[model samples]
Target: MDRPKPCDLVLTLSLSRGRYGVRFAQDPAEVLAAQSLRHRAFFSRTGQSNASALDVDAFDSTARHVIIFDLASADLVACYRVQFLEGAEIAQAYSAQFYDLTALADFPGILMELGRFCLHPEHHDPDILRLAWAAMAHLVDQAGVSLLFGCSSFLGADPLRHAAAIGHLSARIAPPDRLARAKTADRVALNAFAGMGTAAEAMAGTPALLRTYLGMGAWVSDHAVVDRTMDTVHVLTGVEIAKIPPARAKALRQIVTDCLGYNNTVSAMH
Candidate 1:
């Protein structure tokens, strides 16, 4: 397979009413800024008080960072770290803690790990979310990635508290083919949340991020893993980009088009 060109590495989108821009991190300053924004939004106020401003991990050395900046305030609003599968990076995928990856033993082509996703709470505008999705789509298309995987988090460690939500995910979002079924890491099964409800009602009371993933054809693992670093429970999620819902896909494309026009460029990496 041919490698993605440098011009295909980043994307930029602009909105009509409000200003929104999505692009890849070109320097260490931008990456640090994105990490600071994540710290402020997720760690400072949330129960995960122990998290440090530097959210970098094993993936940082080889991962590419995508960031959305609010043009109006000149501030970083949202960020996600993506690592394309190759060499050692493939051996250390982030979702390893929650699922039995061996099930995907035969899956072919390149894999991308999406992790450390976060948005400044104050900038919860839906446009920002749309722009981020657009950036992701562009990246996947450019890289020719076949699978997008990540560990999505729930607020607390107690599954009982989020039983309805977990149940809804299990019912509505089916895993991709049989090859993608989520396997518990340590033999822990999600039996208690097996038959909860629809994805809509289950996540009605939860955060917007999880809901967005469900809308984009993401499926949850059968169990949650305890993440002491974030002080939360997380589930392995996988999405086949080519299979994203039609309506949502169209919307994301529109957002990307709009942003590219505003920036007076066909692509961000250019």
Candidate 2:
């Protein structure tokens, strides 16, 4: 795999009305800015004041950090941590800390795990989200990743509180049966929602980040695990990029072009 190039170039992306930019965090301070953004979004909302003021973990060392910045305000609006899974290192992957990926045991290609995804609550413009995903598509191409997987979180840890969304994913959204199981002792069974949760309700409780994953034809696990530290309920989610519909691929390619500039390789965009 090619080593990720360090970048600090300020990108300007054109929009129908305004503009935004995407940049890879090139230093610890920039990464810390991303962490602070996450800390602000996840902690304050969840009332987890006791947790550290920064959202961080060991994965930050091994992961590549991507951030979307508002060119107008020059503030980091969103962030995601992506790690390439390799060799015995798979045992230490961030997702492995919560779910069982044994089903991918036979898969023989590069896989990237994405995590620490969050957007500043005050910034809800879809352009920021588009920039983040475009950066991700670039990362996936550069690393030659065939599969992208990670944990997508909801506001709170209580499964019943997220029953509608959980049920919807279990009912109609899933990875191949072999790859979507969560192996937690406290995992709530999706079947437990029979006759209770509805798809509409599920959509109501689902977070925007997870919703994006679902739209990409990603699948979720059978259950969500309560994360006390983060004060959120999250499930394992994965998408096979090769399986994305052509139209979706085209949309991502255009976004990357707008965000990263048209000079990017056409093969990478595809």
lDDT of 1 by residue, 10-104 (tens): 44323332566776777788878777776776677555444355666666776788878766565777888887764334446766655557655
As a whole number from 0 to 100, the lDDT of residue 78 in candidate 2 is 81
Question: Which residue runs of candidate 1 sit more than 4 Å off their true CA positions?
Answer: 1-17, 46-52, 86-89, 172-188, 196-200, 264-270
Error (Å) of candidate 2 at residue 129 is: 0.8
TM-score of model number 2: 0.83
Clashes of 2: 2
lDDT of each: 0.66, 0.71
Local accuracy of candidate 2 as per-residue lDDT tens digits, 1-270:
664432222232222213556666777778888888889888887666443578788888877777776665667778888777754455667888887777765555677788888888788888778777887877776666777888888777787787777777775446474365566776776666655666677777788877877778887777778887787788888887888888887887777667554332111000
Model 1 lDDT on a 0 to 1 scale:
0.66
Among the numbered candidates, top TM-score falls to 2
Q: What is the lDDT of residue 1 in candidate 1?
A: 88
> Could you tell me the C-alpha RMSD of candidate 2 in Å?
5.8
